[model samples]
Target: MTETKELSRLKLLAKRYARANRIAQHQALDLVAGELGFPNWNKLISVSKKGWLADSVQMASIEAFVTRALPAAIFRDGDPEAMARRFAHLEQAERGMIGDHTYRLQEILHEVIIAGEGWSIRIPENPGAIPIVETFTNQERECPALEPEFLQKALELARDRAVQVRAEISADWPRRSTKPDQSGMVRHPLCRGESDVWFCLHCDGKITSAQIAQNLWHCPACGASPLDIFDTAFWSDDKGESFLPVKTDGSTDRDELDFRIVDSRPKLDLTEEKIILLIRSALLDDATNISEKLGALQAEISVDDENGVWIIIEEDLWPEGKDPVQALAVAKLLGLEVERLSSWSTIPFAWPRLGEIASSTCDYTQMMLDAYAQYGGSPTK
Candidate 1:
C-alpha cells in the first residue's frame, strides 16, 4: 500500500508536468521515469511491483527535473537549468508597486496578466504581439504604462512568462520545426513541408526560417499564431511567389509602449427587439384573464425608428374600448410613444368570451370544452 501511494504521487507529479509543459501525460511520465533512472514508464511500473518506493530526496529530485523548462531544443546550448534560472525571479504569488498603485502578477493560460485596481495588462503568448493594457475607469489620469520604470517592470515580468510559454510551445512541436538547419531549412509541424522560406496564410507575408524561428513559429508581420503559418501558400495559385517579405523590425523588442484608454462600462441599449420584448412583458402584466393573456401573447408589437411602439391587440380576446394601462406606463418609462390598435383574428378556443366570464383558466377550459361538445361535434378538434 505504501508503494502504491508513492506511485500515485508520481502519477500526480507527471500530470502537473504535462500541464505545465503542454505535453502529453504519457510523455511526461516517461520523462519522469528517465529522471528516476528508469528507461520508461512501463519499466518503472514493473520495477514498482517488486516493492520499490521513492524516498523524499528522490521525489524532490524528480519534481525539480520535471519543473524545469522542457525539451531544451529551443536553446542554443540545450541547457534546462539556465532556462529555469532565467525566470526564477518571478514567484507564484508575486506583487509589486508600480508608481503609487500596486499590481499583482499571475500566469493564466500561458499568458502573463498583471492587474491593478483599475487597470490590467495582458502579455500574449506570441512575443511579436504587443501587450494589451486596459483601464477600467475614465478619470482622465495619466497612463501608468507611459511611465518608464513601470513599463519596464511590467515588460520584464511579461517577457519572462512569454519565454516559458514559448518554451512549452516549442516542446510540443517537432525539433526540426523549432530549430532550423545550417541552410535555414525548417519543417512545418502541421503540413510536414520543409522549406527555408515560409508563408503566412493569415496576412500573406513571406517569412524566412530564421524569422519564424525567432518569432516562435508565430507570424511576425500580422501576429498570427503558428497554426496559420505554412511552408507553402497552398491557398494561392502562385504558391506565394508574388508575396511581399514580412517586415520584422523591432518585433522582438518594444522601445515604447502604446497607451490607449477604452471605456468598458455597462451600457444599456434599447434595441428594437428589446423594446418589443419589454412592451410584450408589460402587456402580460396588464392581462386580467386567460383570454387577455392569449391576446398579449398574440399581440403584434413593433418599434419604429422615431422611438414609437405600435401594438396590435386582438379584438375577440381583448376588450374593445379598454386600454392596456401597464403597457402604456412601460412605454412611457422607456421614453417611447405608444400606438395601440385592435383587430379581429381567429383565437385558439371557440368560445373566447368564456375565458373572460370564468375566474380561472381551468374553469374556462372546462366551460369551453362543454360548449364545444354541445355545439360542435367534438372538443378534441
Candidate 2:
C-alpha cells in the first residue's frame, strides 16, 4: 500500500504548486487536475476513487514530472486571487490524441491552448504566431492559433458556458470520444519513411510516424493541415500510390476544433502601417477639401510595445496647429492608440470676410464641432 492517499498526494502537490506560483491552493489543485486528464479536483477524485492511495515518493516524482512538463502560468498581475478568477472557467485537462499528436486540454489564455506547449500566451510581437516556448524539449509544436484566435476562442468559450445549462454528451454534440487519447488514427501517405517514422510535407521536417498521424496530419512545427500531408517525396517521379489516399478509421478527437470554427474569426491583421492609412483617410473625411492636402502631408505612424499608435503628419495640415490633436481625439473615440510625432500650438486663421480668428486648438475643434452640429454629423463614432 502507498504511504499516503493519492488524493492527498494531489492535494499536497497542489499546495506546493500554489506556493510556487503564488496562486491559491485550490486553484492550484484545479490546475494540477487540468494537468492530469480531469476537469477539476473533484472530478479526478470521483474518477480515481478506486486508486485514491499512492506512494508519497512516487507522488513527488509525478510532481517533478509536472514541474518539467507543465508550463507555469505566470500571473503577472501579482494577485493570486486574480489569477484564480481569470482561469476559473478553464475545464480540466482532457486527454485526446489527434492522429498521432497528443494534446491535453489546458487553457493557454482564454481559448488559446498552446497545444503540447502548455498554457501560454504568444509574445505580442508575433501576434500571428503560436506561443512557442523553446526551452522545453519534449514540447516543440507550433500552430496557427494567434492573438485574434485567442480572443475569438475566449469569447466562444464564454458564450458556450453561458448557454450550457448542463454538461451532458449527446450523439449530435460535436465532442471527442470518451477516451480521446485512444482514438484511432492513420499514418499519412506522403510522409512515411519507415513503418513508424514519417516526414512532414509542409515543413519538410521529420515527425514520429505516430506524431503526424496523431496530429491529424497537421504539421506540429508549422501548423499545416491534412491537405498538405503526403506519404512520400514521390522520389524520381515514379508516380506511385504516393498521391492516393490511404484509408483510415478517422480523425483525432477535435474538441476545440468545432468550437473554434463557430466563427471563422479571421486574424485582425490591422498593422500600424494600416492604422496610419486608416486614420489619414478618416482625417480626410473629417475635414473639407483635406484629402489631397493630408495625402500630400507625409504620414508616419507607429505602434509601441505598450500598444500606443503614434501618428505624424505635416505641420501645415492644421493652420491652427490641431491636426494631431484632432486625430488623437478621433483615435481615442475609436479606442485606438495614437500618438503624434510632430505637434504645435495654434496658428490662428482668419474667417472669410470676418475678423473672427480660430486661434486655439480648442477653437478649431469647436469650429469643426459646430460645423458638424449644423451639418448633422456624427464624428466620434
Candidate 3:
C-alpha cells in the first residue's frame, strides 16, 4: 500500500509504542490498526488499497488512543483495541484526592515521588522494593500520610507513575536491550555488546539474556546500570566461571504496595578529625590580637589516645605566657585536657614584632613591606 504522511506518522508511533511496551513491531502495527477501527493491520492495508483516506477526526482519535497508558492485558488478548478502550475508560490520573487531603505526583530518575503539604511518598523503580513514606514535621498525629486510606491512595498514585517511568526508560533504550531473540541473545545499549549470557562487573552476577532483558539491561542483583554490564567477564581470570547466577526470586508481577518508614534524622559522629577541628576553632575564639589570630590559624592541633588535645603554636607569632583561655574552656567542656606547646620556626616576616604593633593584617602587611623597602630588600626574593 502507498504510504501517506499520516500513515508514516502512525508507523513511527507504533514503533515507539512497541519499543516502550516490549512487543513485536507487527503487534504494534496491529494495535495501531485496531485503534483506527480495523480488525487487524493486514485488513487495514487491504481496505486502504481500495482508495480510503483517514480524515482529521479519525487521525486525532487514533493518536489519542495510542499515546495514553494501555493495559498489558490488551497485548495478550484477541482484540487489542477493545481491551485498550476498556482500560482507557477507567483511566488513572497524576493528581487526585483520596479524601480531604490532596496530592501531586512526579517521577525522578525512574522513581515516583508523591508529595503533599508536610509529607511525601517515594515509590522505588524496582517493583519488589518497598515504598517509603516520609513526614517533614515531627507532629506525626497531624500527618495525612499516617491515615490508612490516604496512604494507600498516595502509594497507588506513585506506583502508577513509577510504572510509566519504567516504560519511558525501556523506550529510551535499544530494542534488543529489552527484548531478546529466539536464541536468548540481547545487546547492551551502552557497550553494544551482544551475548546470550551477560556478566555484571558491579556484582559479579551471571545473567541470562532473558534475565537481562527482564531487568531492562540493569543488574538485578546489584541494580547496576547498563554501562556496568559486559558481554564477557574480561576482568575475571576464569572467564565468568566463578560468577554466580543472579537470583531474581524477589521480583514478581504483583500489584501489592508494601511500605516502610524511614528516619532521616541527622546524627553527629565524633572522630579525631572533628575533635581537632573543634579545638582549632576554639583557638581562633581565644585569639586577642592579629599576631595571635595568625598563630591560631597556623596552629597544629592533634587528638591524643586519652581524650587529650595537643596544640602547637608558633613562638614568633604567639606571645610567651599568654594562655589560650577560650580554647582551654572549650576543651574542658568537651571533657578533654589541653597540652600547649610552642615551636620556634622561620616566621613569615623578618620582624616578628611588626604584626604585634599593627591592629590588622592589612596594616601589618604594609608596615612589613615598608620596613623591608627601607632596608633595601623585599620580604621574599
Candidate 4:
C-alpha cells in the first residue's frame, strides 16, 4: 500500500512537470509562428520561410520530441540535482526557440498586462496622485456622453468665428486704372469698304454709318443701342461732309469734313442697379454725366489697355453680421461679380465690425481694427 501511494505521488509530480514543459513549449511555438506570420504551430511546422515544402515539420517534430524526452530521461536515471539542471536546460531551449532578445519578454508581458484585469482600475480623484497601472486599464472602456445642446452650440459658434476670420484675412485690391489711351480702341486689320474701321465705343464693334443723325449711331453687326459721336478721328471712303482737317489744306478742310463714320460710341454696358451700387460705394463720387462715370469706373477697373473693366468688392463692404443668404441676394441684385476672398485678414480694406467677441481675451474685431490702422486705411497702389 505504501509503495503504491509513493508511485502515485511520483506520477502526479511528473505529470505536473510535463504539463508546465508543454505550456512553455507551446508559448515558444506561438511566438515563432507569430514572427513568421503563421496562424498556428501546425501551419508553422508545415511551412518554411520560402513557403515551399521543406523538412520543417520533421525538423521541429524531432526537436520537440528530443526536448520532451531529455527531461524525463534525466529525472528517471539521474540524481535530483541532475533533474533540476535538465529542467533549467529545457527552459533555456524553449526561450531560445522564440528569441534571445529582451524585447520579446517585454512584448509578451505587455500583451498580458493589457489583456488581463490591468484595465479595470479607476483613476484617482486626487489631482496630485500618481497614476497606477489599473487607471490606464479603466480608461479603455470609458465612453463619456456629451450634451447635444452644448455640442450644437459650440459648432455654430465655431462656424461664425471661421467666417469672421476668413473675412479679416482676405486681400485688399487697388483701384482699377481707367485711362483713355490707345488700348481703349482695338482695331481690326480688315477694313469695311476700303476704310479703316475702328471699334465703336458704344457697340463694342466696327461702325459702318456715314450719317451722324443726332450725334448717335448703331452697329450693323451687333444692332447695339446708338452712341454719341465724340470728338475723334475717323476714316471715310466718300468725300462729302464737314469736320476737322487731316492736313492744313487751307481749302476749308474738305478731306477731314468728308470723313465717314468708321467708329461711334465707347463700349460700356452699364445697368441701372450697378450704377446705383457704384454711387453708393463712393466709387463714383464726382459724376455730372452718367457716361463719364461709367467711363471712369471702366478705366479705374482696367488692368491693361485691353479696354475691359474688372470690378472688385471691398471686404468690409460685404455683409458680415447679416444673413448670408440675404447678402448674396443683394450682391446678385447689384449686378456685380462677387468673389469670396479666402484670406480676409490680409486683404487691403477696412475691417467692418462683425460682432462683439464672446471673450475679452480674444477680441477679433479689435485686433482687426488695430491691424488696419497699422497697415493704413487702404491698399497700396
Candidate 5:
C-alpha cells in the first residue's frame, strides 16, 4: 500500500481505539465515584476527563492517568464521536500534534494500557524522574604538560585518597565490621585474636580478650550475639586415628548429643533446643533472656545492646507432628523461621545395605541398635 493509505488506515485504527478508551475511562470514573459515595458523579467524571488533557499535566502524571482510565473507557459502549473528541483533545494536549507520530503514540499507549494493567506507566521512586537526553560540548583549553609517569602517579594518589575517605566514612557507620588506621590497615577484634572478645555478626559491637569471654561474645552495642558451637561427636577409624572434639570447659569425654529418636521414629524429643542453647552459650555468658524465650517456645526475639537492637531467631524450631505445609503455616502464625536439613536422612550409612546393616550392628552402632530394639525389632540377624 502507498504510505498515504497506510498512514490513513493507521490513523483510523488509532481513532477507533482512542474513542473506545475514553468511554471506558468515563465509565470507570463514574463507577469509582459512585462506590466512593460521591454526590455528583458528573463532576468527578468531568474533573478526571479534563485532568488527563490539561497542557500543564506532567508527562509522568499523564501517562499514569491514561494507563488506568483509557483501557476501561475503550471496553465500554458509548457515543464514538464524543469519545473520539475526548481522545483527540488528549492526543493534542499530550503531543501538541495530530500527525502519524501522534497516531502511533496513541496506538502504543493503548496497547500498554490494555496489556500492562497500569504497571507499565508507574514512575520508579529511587531514581526519581527519568533523565532527559542532553548534548555535551567539549571546549579545548591549553594546559601545562607534565611527565607521563608523574601524571600516572598523581592519578593513583587521587584514587587512594578517595578510597581512604570512603573507608573512613564507612567505618563511622554503626554496623561497620572494620576500622582503618592511618596506614589503611583494617583493625578489628576478630583480626587481633583477643582471648576475651565479644562481637556481633549483625551489628558493630565487639569487645576483645577477657571481655569477650566474660560477655560471651554478645555485642553490647547492637545486642547481636553469636550462636554457641558445640562438638556433638567425634568420628575415628579402627586404627585409633580420631579427630579431637572441640574443648568446652576442658571436658573431652562428654557423650555426643543424639539427634535421632530411640525407636528410630521421628519425634520432637530431640528438639532444636540444644542447638539454640549451644549458640547462646557460645555468644553470651548470661543468656537468661534468650533461655526464657526459648522455654516459652518463642522462636524469635529482639534484644537491645549498646550498638542497637538485634532480631534473633531459633532457625530450626518446627514441631515434629506437622508436615511441611502445616509447619510453614505454623511458622507464619508464630513468626518463626524454619531451616531444612541439607539431607533428608541425618543418619549416615554405607551403600545399599545402609539401613539393614545399621539395624544389626552393635558397639559402634549401639545407637541404631537401641532404636531398633525400642521398635520391637532385633538388632542382630
Candidate 6:
C-alpha cells in the first residue's frame, strides 16, 4: 500500500479512539502504537517511513494480543482512563528476555521490573523529579545490570534530560534563568563551572560540559561529589590552560554542636518519655490522648549512638504478635532504627511476614499475594 493510504488508515484508527476516549488524536495514536507492540507514535511512524504497511492481519493480531494480555486489575479500582494510560506506558517499556525471563508490571507502584532468570535492571532515572539517580554496583555506572552496549544506550537516553533538568533546578534555585560568563558562554548556576569543559577532582575524569551536567555536576563514572569538580586539571602533570575561576560563597552543611549525634539524619529532639508517648499514640486505634488505646502494653525503649531504637515490649500483656508489629511499623515509617528486642526472639515458632510493606495486619492480605489491599472497605457515605 502507498504511504498516503497507510497514514490515512492509522489516522482513522487514531481518530476513532480519540472520539471514544475524549482524548487528543495524538494521544490515541500513541496508545494504539503502544498496544500494537510499538514504543510510541514516533516509533510507529519510523517503521512506517521504512515501508511498514497497516495490513489487516497484522492489525487484527495486535488487537487480539492486547485483548488477551490486558491485566484484570486495570478495571479493578482506579479511574479507567488513568489506569489505561499507565498500562500503555508499561507496554512501551524497553524489555529484555533471556531464558524464562520476562517483565512484570506492579500496577500499584507503577514500576516495570525487567528481570531475567537471575538478574534484573533498575534505572534510577527521573532527572526532572529526583535530582540525582545515584545507584551503582560498579565503578562506572548507575545501572548495575546494563552491559556496555545497553549502558551506552541508556546514557544517550538520559544525558540530555538530566542536564536540562539540573540546569533548570540550579537556575530556579538561584533566582535566575541561566548564568553566562564574561565571554558570553553560559556557566552553570550551581558551581559556575565552564559550560563546555570540566575535570572531576575525585575520579580524575575529563568530561565535556554536557557530560558533566548530565551526571548532576558529579563524576558519572565514579559518582563523586559536586565539590570535587573543577574547571581546571589541577592534578595534571602539566598544568592546563587558564582555568575558569568559579565564584561561590563557602557554605557547607556542618553542625558544630556541643555533643555530636553523627547519624545519617539530623536528630529529632524527643525525650525518652516523648518517644514512648509518640509510639503509643501511633499504635492507638480510634481514640486518642493515650487513655482509649488498645491492650495493657508497656514499652522500654533505648537509643544507641547510631540512633538504633531498641524496644523491649512487655509481650505478655499485648497477647497478639500483631500488636508489636504495628508499633514496629510506626517506628520503621518514622525512619527510626528499630530492632524487636528478643525475649525468646530466635526465630520463634511463628513469624509474621508483611513482604516488603514492613507491616500487614491479619485483616488485610487475605486476597491474592500480588493484589493491592484496600483499606477501610466501602466509605461510610
Q: What is the C-alpha lDDT of each candidate?
A: 0.76, 0.43, 0.77, 0.30, 0.29, 0.43
- Give the candidate number with the greatest lDDT: 3
In model 5, the Cα lDDT at residue 37 comes to 43
Query: Whose TM-score is greatest here?
Result: 3
Provide the lowest-lDDT 10-residue window in model 3: 84-93
Backbone clash pairs in model 6 (N, Cα, C under 3 Å; residues 3+ apart or in different chains), count: 0
- TM for candidate 4 is 0.15
- Any runs in candidate 1 off by more than 4 Å, and if so which? 1-89, 92-102, 138-152, 288-290, 346-381
For residues 84-131, write the lDDT of model 2, one tens digit per residue: 433443342334443343444433222333243323222211111233
| TM-score, predicted candidate 1 vs. hidden true structure | 0.63
Per residue, candidate 5 scores C-alpha lDDT tens digits across 93-142 of 32222221121111231111100111112111111112111112222421
Off by over 4 Å in 4: 18-104, 107-340, 343-381
Off by over 4 Å in 3: 1-15, 24-62, 70-102, 109-111, 123-135, 139-143, 146-148, 249-254, 258-260, 302-316, 319-350, 366-381
Question: Tens digit of lDDT per residue, candidate 6, span 1-381?
Answer: 456675676667665444332234566677678766687789988898888776887677544432321221232232447445544443444553322334321211211233333234332322212212223234342333334444333332233222222333443332211222344333444555444566667666665554444344545555565677777787876544443323222111111211111112244677766666766655554222221222213455666667567766434323334545566666777668777653423221112232223233332234313243253343232
Listed in order, each prediction's TM-score against the native is: 0.63, 0.26, 0.73, 0.15, 0.12, 0.23
Candidate 4 has an lDDT of 0.30
| TM-score between candidate 2 and the true structure | 0.26
For model 6, give the RMSD to the true fold.
Answer: 22.0
Between the candidate structures 3 and 4, which one is better when assessed by lDDT?
3
